[model samples]
Target chain A: MQPTSANFIANARDAIADDNLQLAIARVGENFGAKRQQAVDKLPEFDALCGRAVEIKDDVLAHLDYYLEVYERAVTASGGHVHWCATVEEACETVLRLCRSVDAKTVTKGKSMIGEEMEINPYLERHGIEPIETDLGEYIIQLAGEPPSHIIAPAVHKTKEQVTDLFHEHHRKFGKTERLTEGEDLVAEARELLRGKYLAADVGITGANFLIAETGSSIIVTNEGNGDLTQMLPKMHIVLASLEKVVPTLEDAATLLRLLARSASGQEMSSYTTLSTGPRRADDPDGPGEYHVVLLDNGRSELLGGEFQDILRCIRCGACYNHCPVYTSVGGHAYGWVYGGPMGAVLTPALIGLAEARHLPSATPFCGRCEEVCPMQIPLPKMMRHWREQSFQRRLTPGRERLAVALWAWFARRPALYHLGARFAIGWLFRRARGRGHMRKVPFMRGWTLTRDLPAPEGGTFQQQWRRRKRA
Target chain B: MSNKTQGGRATILGWIRGSLDRGELSAEQRAAIDSRLANPRRNLIPARAQVDHAAQVELFLEYLGAANGTFTRVAAEADAPKALSEYLSSQNLPQRVAMAPDAWLQGLPWEKGAPLLERRAGPARPEDQVGVTGALAGIAETGTLMLVSGPDSPSTLTMLPETHVVVLRASQIIGAMEDGWDALRKREGQGKMPRTAIFITGPSRTGDIEMHMYLGAHGPRRLHVIFIDES
Candidate 1:
């Protein structure tokens, strides 16, 4: 999970060249985009729900300290322990200590972005605890020895045929010698394989969608019930969450829930939205015996009062990612982080520092589709602009680009000189290129013309055209 | 273990408190927050869920159907087991089914079994083919069945088995998710909830592989509801 965000340009090119990844992410472009539209259209109060969701998150953030203390007290009251971690190392070590306390050999996990951020799997392996990803997408990627590409659909970069190969290669360990072709058969094979892990594991780890402060519950939404099985069957349930996840009450959580599923995957509700308060009570028949939450700040507390605070309101719905043209084109892997798309563009620079992730913000076309679809009403484009400014202030922009921008700005400041330069340049280009009306090569735009020709300036500049049209 | 920061908790809370730049909330602010927590205001609810009781049941069935949840409405609660066994027979499933000890599921007529084999009210075991339970409430807006775990109602019985047959009374159906919360607050006291409250909308499914859905990813592949209509 080491970030290639700094090398985003090269990674994006590689992703564009990857046929399997392109084919896989195209399905997201069609599936999530259409599903979300249909779901939103069906709900008349969808906009109102989004507005309320934004309000609820803003409230939680303003009183984050108060709400988190309330959440901790409530979890303690419900017989669950809450552990706070300021750094990723602390979070990983805390989870390790909990696993070690249970003498855990085998561990099970659902799809958790925070776990990936902490690189929990490799850490667990180093400590001799085998971590098994129980969700089908996570399990597939785990078997393939790759980090999840998408937040919601982890294996969206792999095709059915590729999955068939991964299963054919991996299922031999579980004594299935045959290769599976269809998605259903592959899922069944993984289910049969992980069902055993779910029962055998001593600890289960999951991520929270919303942590209710009023009830000390960690809510997870999933179409597959892997999270339910991962948590309910294990001896200990450890929830990994960021500090921003806590909400004031179940009613607040309820208001956000109205917008969550519709925005994420367009379901009214995911198959199972399980809210785990504590472990199994003494009188309960079956559930994990212990419950613990590892709440990680990981630079988010700094974001609370800053200009980037709005990003914390994110529900991790992936709608912004789904609607992002750049993401759908290059896919999630090119972003080179656990999160991708527009949200990633704004967030990666903030978390990992602009020096390392400066390229992520510039990767956007400023289409603003991500902000339009975001349930939290995050101004994604504006945040990207902010990151761009920060990177510029740090002198992280390339020397050639900075000079080119300065040269353009010199002319741009004086409209008369700018127009004179533009008229002369157009006249010169028109004399040579009026025949074809296109330029196969252009200065300072090789990257743009690398794949196709730039349209030659056949007509007069805008002022001339406007004067001509107005006269007519 | 030694590397675990002893001050991690205090440092994080301090950072959060400091980021707001307010040392403490004023009495009025505290009272406002406390009151908001004590009495959560009902936000804008989807108009679809605000309907008559019969319409609520109809909406529940419709929404559940959209989620791929199968349903069979019986004439009365007494006829649930018979209808359930018939559905099981149709699916060519095993005759034996595990169930929660909810009074409603317990009241089903176990003696009137022809196709049905044996039923026990307990936690689901590894060999159980089907698990039956009674839902605490049914959400009409999204066709979600709410199940709260207790000594008599294990979360396992709903999640473990290959097939789940939930017995939902028509009267328990509520409109909107907020109404469902109201129902839970009424059933239990305010500020207290079951250890686990699951809202199940459909059988377990995963679209992880190229966005193609496959059911029973980790929980029940087949979810059959023996919904008893109110006479």
Candidate 2:
């Protein structure tokens, strides 16, 4: 995956132009948001749960090095192999080597964002090994040859009708000619299609939501039973997860689970919450014969000792995405990477240098809704501001924005000049708009006016209004 | 591909030593791991005593009812056949049922010669009705069911159907979420959790697309709970 966070604002502006997608997104987002709010309100201990979750994550990160070692030891002791990769390419190569070791002809996959980050599907395909996405949303996107749009709902941007069309186009190549009109028909078709792949595949790939260091386990949650099938039926199972997913113990993981579902989808619990440690036991009747954990550092080591370290606490519950105003408007694909929404904004800059993802931090209207709803309570806007500062320092920001900031700072040093400059601009803009009272066109403000007109500065600046009120 | 190129790949020992030399982690930090591992036990918040099975069952029914799921109780596993027969008749459905062949179903006596109604397979279609074999370990504190799939039970029973009728044994019920986790860990082991361990409270539901609540949008529309008590 090439980083696309920089082009998000531009892509989002174009996405909003599609009336149907905009309508569906707005309607769906508002409903999930309200349901989540109601769910939180029903539980008196919701805030306490959030606090406990954050504390658990904080403790785990503080001792992450220890927990990671413990996790590695336990997993290896259980007859599983552990490989540490410092970057995305290393991780991908490790997985490929493992596949070659097993002579894997076909691979079945559960939803793993780390796999997306490594662009594993294409890599596996290039090696002449087939990789099938078992999750319904992921499978649909796979058929369309598009990246997943949402963390939870990978194909959230596509409508049911669109899915029906995609299935019609691809189903025939597999010798299936029937076209499904309803959602259920589509689901049934996908189930039959993926099951054959699952049974025939030599290896299974999945993502872990949390890595329990105490027990050396990889925890996964899913509503559909496909993930279980992927991990169990295949001869080999591989988990690709980031370095920061480790938690100290089962109890800490329990605390995080209490808030994960409620924050993500307002469910008391998801349909399936699974934790796998190594390969199957000697007494176990059914499971993969081999298990491997690929731990990807991918620039996270630098984040461990920095101000934006709180971002490492993220469990990818996607609460921040659901609550973001910008994400709700454009949906996930516009972020143009494996992760999207508020978490993506904070993470994209850190993973793929700030020089490339500069606009992601500025894309936010600074709404602060992401922080308010985050399960780990990651101070997202503050982290984004840190990214912005880095962008400014690196001279990555455009010349115009830099000049504007410099001029504003200069006038800001002289309070009288600042008030006069603001007052004059406001009066002139208001008069130019002529009672319409909004600037449809303005110099050096095309970014603001591109999507929506800016409301004329309300007759005067805040400083002037505040001084007049005080005198009165 | 060549021997020289193969040798170019760094060894694990080299990487470890390099990381150590980077000096990112402190010496005190490396020592702390040994101390923590030497003593693994930590203080735990003891879970509360379990509620009686009857009360636990009733609480689950009530919670499910609040979430708009239907409920029916049978005398035993044998009674499930008659119960399902009448239930199926009432819905005026054909002799097609998607069944997850778990241990629970093996224990149940299917209609003597009904030819095991068209076995629903693979992904659930909206038209399909699946009979899931449930090993329900209920959490009374939150009124939840912990379902695990194995040889006796297939994963398809809970999902891939229009209606789901889960048979819950009284003994399988536990008191709290933690207890259920502990029990599951003990059964499977510290490491191997099932691929899909669904803690379902009620039927499949969604409020998206519009605020109007819609049940059975993605998964099962009607969830019917069957309580079986051998005692």
Candidate 3:
């Protein structure tokens, strides 16, 4: 997980030029976006629920410490274990220790984004434990040996043809040699291959969409029931989540569940929304024998009560990515992290630091669509703007950009000079492109002029035109 | 190793306290938090899930079908076993199935009713082609079946088999998830939760490959529900 956010401009340029990815992404680019609109249209109370969802998360954050302690106590009471880790390494080590205690050699994993954040697959591999991704999207990426491009849809950047080839290349050991072209056949092949792995693995790892403090239950919402299989058949189940995922009660979790699916895939509910409280009961004939939850802070705890505290309310719904014009154009790989799109932009800087992720804040055009579509009503744009301010203050931005901003501010303070400069520049540009009516190239702003033509300015500013009309 | 992890936890809590600038809460705030934890409030619910009983059942059937599931209504509890056997025969699936050991299901004559079917009350084996279980409650708002894990009800019966059959009583259907939980509390008592409470809407499905959904990925390929009337 070496960050390439510092090279976001280059990565985005490359992503734009990747026609194969563009072709694949374009097929389903507006798929989630349009479906979300339809689902929202059907639910009259979506906005009201969003408002309440925000209120609920705010209530949790206001007393996060108390909720975490209560959640821990509940987990302990239910014969489950809870571990708090401040860093990614500690979380990984804790998982490895638990795995080693069970003499685990192979581990089956559900789609846990926190596992991606800690880069657990690689860590586990280095320690001689083979990690198998059971989620179809995650499995495809694991075969390709690439990080997930999108949160919900990991192999969204790959076309079916590419997946056909990847499966053909890697699944030979499992005897799935035929290149599957259709989605059904491909999913079936992966299912058949992973079925044995699910029952054979010594441990299962999953991510929690929400952790209820009232009952010490970790809930995972999935269209595919791989998460259920992963957690059920294994002898031990480990859940990786951040501290912010804790809620006060199951009812609170249910309230948010109504919003999660509609916002995520436009479904009334995901095919499976399973809540695992602890290990199997003594009388129970099935389920994991042991249950463990590893809670990682990793800098999220520092955002409490801060200007960016609102970002903690995010429910990992990729609505913002679906609605983002930039994200749709470049796809998720350009973000160069586990999280992509608007939420990624706001969160990447906070987790990694502003020095490396400074450009992420500038990745947006301050469109309010993300906020409008967010289930928790997170103020994404305002938080991105905060990051922008911090970037400049910390001198994380380039020197020339800082100087240009400073020069603009100086002129902006003097309205008369600003207007005069505007008029002169407009006149100069207009004269230079009298017949062309557009400037294909401009001095000191080649970045804007390189691909797009700037419209030639008119004869006068709006203020001068208004004055002349008044006089007439 | 435990000491290191514990130290990390303390340091993290310290950072959280410093950032919030109110590490110590006043008496009133602590009381409020404790009260909220004790009785979590139910927030705004979508009006779509709210309706009269008959309408709620209709909505449940509609939404479940929308999730690519099928349902059948039987006249009474005695007819449920026969209907399930007919379903297995029609689908050409193996007659051997795993059933949950709930008292209600144990009372039913699954083997006698479906003479061709070989059934046992226990957790599902990988070889079992079908798993039949009873739902504790049905949420009409989303067509979700709530299955609580217990001695009588094993969690794997609903999850392990390729095909799942859920037998529900019409009277157990609730309008919303909150109401469903309320009923669960009234039945199971406060803070006495099962190991797991699974809300299954449809057969296991995934759109991971090119965002095109394919049912029966790692869980049930087909989810069939049979609701029995109050005979």
Candidate 4:
């Protein structure tokens, strides 16, 4: 989980040239994007609900300390323990201690981005407790020994053939050697194999979509029922969540839930939206015995009241990922961290430091599709722009790029010089094109024109056209 | 709390307060936040869920079908076992079912109405093919069933089996998720909730492999709702 975001350009180049990744990204981009559009079109109140969701999150962020204290009190009153960890190491150590207390050998995990952020799997493995990802996507990637490619669909980058191969290799020890070609067979095989792990796991760990202060419950919205099975069968259940996930009440959570599924996968509702309050009640026939919540605040508190504070309102729906052109082109791993796409471009720098993830902000073309589709209305492109400005100010940008920008700024300050330079550059490019629509090679832009042609500029600048129109 | 945990708590809250550019909240500010939490406000409810009772029921059925969940309407609760039997036979599934030990479900005439059907009342086992439970309410907005776990209503019955059958009363159908929350508040009182409240819209599914959705992904493949109408 060490950040490779600084190598985003190299990673993106590899992703673009990857045939298998391209095939997978094509399907996800087309399918999830269209489905979200269809779901949004169905609900007349979708936008209104989005606005309300944003307001609710903003309210929580404004009174975050108060709400979190209230949330901690509620969890304690419900006989559940809440652990506050300011750093990922502390969070991982807390989980390890809990697992050790229970003498856990294996733990079942639902798909949790926060768990990925904490890198709890490897941490637990090193401490002698095995962690199993029960979600089919997370399972596939875990088998493949890779981080997730998408937030919701972890194995999205793996084609069916890749999954068949992964299963064939990993399931051989389980006495299953069949190379499953069909998606249904693959899913059934995983389901059959993981069902026992769920039963045997001593503890369950799931991420919270929303932590309700009203009921001290952690809500998980999943299409697969693995999360429920993970928590229900285990002796202990632990919820991993960032601090911003808390809401004032169940009613507030309901408003966000209304937009979650519709924006994420274009469903009216996910298959299962489970809210686990605390450990099993005394009279309960079946449930976990002990419940614990780990509230992680790794770098989130630093984002508050800053220009980047809006990113905390994100619900991790992956809507922005699906809608981002840059994300669709190169896919998630190109972003080089636990999160990817527009949100990651803005947030990775904040959490991991701008120096390590400076390239993420500059990876975008600033098309602004991410903000348009975001359920929380996080201004992703604007945040990315903020990161870019910070990068430049911090001298993280390349010296050559800085020089180019500085020169452009100098000219921009003098409008007459800028217009004259624009006229001269347009005339030279127009002649270089030889009436062709595009140029195959351009000086100092080999990276841009290598895979695609640069369109030839017209002979006149906008200023010339405007003055001509005015005179006519 | 351990000292380590207390340190973390103080550090995080301190940082949050510092970033928000404030000391501890004033009494007025605390009162405002406490009031907001005390009296939760309802936000926008979609027009789709705001309809007449008959229309809501119709919308629920429509959306349920759209979500790939099957349902059968019966005139009386006694007919539920018969309807469940018919559904199992139609789908060529086993006649055996693990039923939740809820008192309401136990009153159903499984033995009298469907003698051939084998039913065990308890939490669902891994080998169980079909599981039946009673739902707290059905949300008409998205065709979701709201179920709370308790001594009688085991959570496993809803997820462990390959096929899950729910017996919901038509009168228990609510307009939206907010209404469902309101009902839970009225039943459990404020700040008191069941251990788990699951809202199931359809059978378990996954689009993980090649983004091709497959049902019965580690949960029930078929979700059959048996609606009892005693009106």
Candidate 5:
């Protein structure tokens, strides 16, 4: 999971040129975007619910230490262990040690963003425990040997034909020879194969949508129910969650649950919303024998009470991802990280350094759709602007860009020189058009002119027009 | 716990406190948080789920159908076994099924009604074609069924089979998810919860393959609810 955010421009160019990626991105934009609108339209209290959700998450962040302690005490009371890890390396080692304790060879995994952040699969493989992704999108991407392109929809960049190829190539080892074309057959084949994996795996790992401090339970919302089986059939269940996921109570979790599925995939409810408190009781018929939670910091604790604290309220619904124009155009791989789209643009630089991910904040068109559609009311565009300011202050921006901005500022400080320069530039550009309304090329703006013609400057500057109007 | 884990916990909590510019919480703030956790308040409930008893039942049925789940309403609890058998025969599924061993489910006269069906009460095996269990509550807001795992109610009955049959009493219908949580809190008491509590809306599904949703991805393909009118 080494970031290619430094090479975002190249990756975006490649994504834009990929036909299959374009088709998949269009489906996300058209399908998920329209469905979200319809779901929102159906709920009259959607805005009110979103406001309340924001309040809940903000409250959690303000007193995160208290809530985490309450949550840990509750888990301990329920016979579960809580492991706190400040860094990804510590988190990975904790998981490996737990697996080793159970003498586990294979572990089934539900879709977990923290797992992606920790890069636990590769870490486990290096240590001899094999991790299997049971979620369909995650399984597809795992076989393709690629990181998830989308947070919710991991293999969203792959076409069905590509999936057919992936399953055809990988399922050969399982003695399946025929190539499946229909989506149903592909799902069936994977389900059949993974059923055994779920039974055989010694441990299960899942991410928590919310950890309730009232009851010390971790909740997962999913449609396919792979997570339910993963935790139920295994000997141990380990929940990987960041500190920000903890909520105060079950009622708070319910309020957020009302928004999660609709914002994520336009469903009234996901097929399965399971809350696991601890391992099986003595009188219980069947369940995991051991329960553990790995509470990760991984830079999230540093975001508290800062200008970027609102980003921690994100529920990972992918509504902002669906609504982002740049994300829809370039797909998620171009972001070159676990998270993608508007949220990723703001969060990547914070988790990783701004120097390594300077291009992400600058990649936005600032249409404000992401902010408008966010369920938690996070000001994504404003946070991206913050990142931009920090990058500029750090001089992480390219030298040429800094020089242009500095030169513009130098003239901007003198209004008279700025007006004179503007007038000269406009007149020269108008003449260069040679009576045409547009120019195919422009100096130092080739990026803008590459895709579409630049409109020739029409009329004088705003100040000139204002003076002339006053005189008349 | 290991020293490393304890140190990590202390360090993270310290960082959070430092970032917030506070070393310790005042007496009032701690008291407020304690009360909030003790008595969790219910937030806004949508108008769609706020209804009378009869209307709530109607809304639940409407949403269940909308979510692609099928159901049958019976006047008595004894009718569930017959209805389940009919459903299995109609769908061309196997006569044998894995059923949850809840007292209410076991008390039913499966021998008198649907005698041809061979039912085993336990956790579902990999080869089970159908699973039968009783639901804790039916949510009227989104046609969801709340199933909690316990000694009698195995969690696997809902997931391993291709088809799932849920028996619910009409009296158990709730107006919203908040109501369901309240019921669970009353049953399990404060600071206690079951190992697993699953709220299932419909059959398993996925849209990852080109965004074309296909049912029965890894869980039950069909979810059938039998509402018994205990009133």
Candidate 6:
């Protein structure tokens, strides 16, 4: 069951109503954005690095078919099995099939948007395989059975007390004796519970942050070692990745890696950056016996030849979301689906048709903060406008919105009538309000003035004031 | 971004991918791959960076301090156990410390009375205070330590403990990211890499709750790096 934009908006409003979430979000953006600026200031060639990173992605995408083949060959050469999935269903089926082949009863997963995008947990559940999310935030959300609201912080919508209650409720079945009191206590409790799951799980699944074509290595950056454990310890390891994650070489990936952590969390680097190439060797005492790489194309192949190609370069750093005014106001869940924030606004409509996601593009305030802070320098506002144009062309926009825009456009093109009509309406409306200096009700703007009063017009219209100034 | 195109005109991307499919590499991709391939010809692909005793000690202190890890430079491998014991005693850690099965660790001199449990098979309990192991390599760029699983440092010692104490030798330091990958390749041989090569930069942290970072979210809360200058 996919959540619609309306449902997400309701959830986000509730999340914003929480005092803790607001305070935490306020502290995060200011500190993280400042630290990232400091890091970039030290590196004189940061912009050049971004350009190079963009270039590498662009080139790889142009030759994606060849590069994917090269990556597959390299992985196979390194004794890792590579599975190609043309769609999300195929990708999910491939992972489930692998799990079944291994007779996997328990599966532990790292935080992967790809996993979220494919709805992997429910698929695994249907097969009677319990997929345990190892990342703390992911684990919390999995227990709550909710889709992640934010990209970086999946359970950002949750408060500490909520997490505590969740843990208490979930841990009751496990016969947990000690009740956690603080945030730290809760973390320790989760760790103790997940440790056994890590060791016992037959298969581990994670999403690749980036896949190196030259080395057949899949890069996963995590501040927690959950990703590491998810890739190791288990006998079988699977890395789910999109086609756009491929890079030409390790050096190119290095440039992007430098930016990823600083932009995401203001860290010099994530606590754990694991690069796994293949399965364990004979000399290795403990590691996964079988390694699998699932490359999901989904809609990316079509996106390659479209206007949304630039979105493929996103590193999922969540910087845009952190700095975005709309995102800060309404939060991530408001946009709905796997991805939220500005990226989701442009991407959701692209992946799923504009009609199903018409309201998502309209969710933004067009403050342009997302584009300004975007490390990839994606023209997000322009893309949103593009979607708006598409919606208008398809008549997916509401009748009222269409009428309003049409009226504005008609008056805008005819200057004489527009000015006369604007002046008369302003004066007439003011007189009708009986010197109240504001209006509590307007025709189409009833929704707008319902909560607050609209300030009366100052003096007269701009055209009238300009004419009087010219005469004087 | 346009919905429609001319009768026969292909889009910018169509032209690019179509040409690439015909083996006509773009000027950019060709340039990048060529430059990378040509790098070895210019400079004999230098050996991995090495750190000596003093340098390793300096790096250990700097990295540990920067990354919120505690470090003590010991004069000899014999003094390692004493420093570790002192750290644990001060922190009120349990009497028993889990030691990895390594030859270098076995050579350490400890208090004659204290009991140190050598690592065995199976899951480690929550009561476990510390796990000691040697790092496979250290990355200078990110101040990270690469831990490879083997007989020397069993994998469980890394994840199971409340505190992790890593004994690092200075000489194994590598300068570049590629140097680390090269070393891993050489160690694993062709077509074989470990299922996991964890490059731990600092303690575990997450900003999941409205982006308030809390360290020790899932892994070891405390990391102690013991720099050994055997040189």
TM-score between model 6 and native: 0.86
Model 6: CAPRI class: acceptable
Model 5: per-residue Cα lDDT over A1-472, one tens digit each = 9999999999999999999899899999898899888888989999999999999999999999998988999999999999999999999999999999999999999999999999999999999999999999999999999999888889988988999999999999999999999898999999999999999999999999999999999999999999999999999999999999999998899999999999999988889999999899999988999999999999998999899999999999999999999999999999988888999999999999999899999998899999999999999999999999898899999899999989999999999999999999999999999999999998988999998998998888989889999999
Stretches off by above 4 angstroms in model 5 are A466-472
Native contacts retained by candidate 6: 0.46
- Cα RMSD to the true fold for all candidates: 1.6, 5.2, 1.6, 1.1, 1.2, 6.0
lDDT of 2 by residue, A219-306 (tens): 8876665676678777899999887898766666767777777777776566557767777666454577799988877877667647
Candidate 6 on A30-141: residue-level lDDT in tens?
7667877776675566676677667777877777765666677778887888776656787788898899989999999999998987899999999899999999989999
Per-residue error for A257 in candidate 5, Å, reads 0.7
Clashing pairs in 5: none
Q: Which sequence of candidate numbers ranks them by lDDT, best first?
A: 5, 4, 1, 3, 6, 2
Interface CA root-mean-square deviation for model 3: 1.3
lDDT of 5 at A113: 97
- Tell me the TM-score of each prediction against the true structure: 0.98, 0.84, 0.97, 0.99, 0.98, 0.86
C-alpha RMSD between model 6 and the true structure: 6.0
**C-alpha RMSD of candidate 3:** 1.6
Give lDDT: candidate 2, residue A161. 76
Interface RMSD of 2: 5.9
- The deviation in Å at residue B35 for candidate 5 is 0.9
| DockQ pick, better of 4 and 5 | 4
Residue pair clashes in candidate 4: none
How close to the true structure is residue A96 of candidate 2, measured as C-alpha lDDT? 93
lDDT winner, 1 or 4: 4
Model 5 fnat? 0.88
User: Scoring each candidate complex against the real one, what DockQ results?
Assistant: 0.78, 0.20, 0.77, 0.89, 0.89, 0.30
Give the residue spans of candidate 2 off by over 4 A.
A430-436, A450-454, A457-460, B1-55, B63-71, B75-136, B141-143, B147-166, B184-225, B229-231
lDDT of 3 by residue, A84-147 (tens): 9988998999999999999999999999999999999999999999999999999999999999
Regions more than 4 Å wrong, model 4: none
lDDT of 1 by residue, A246-298 (tens): 99988788888888888889888889998998889889999999999999999
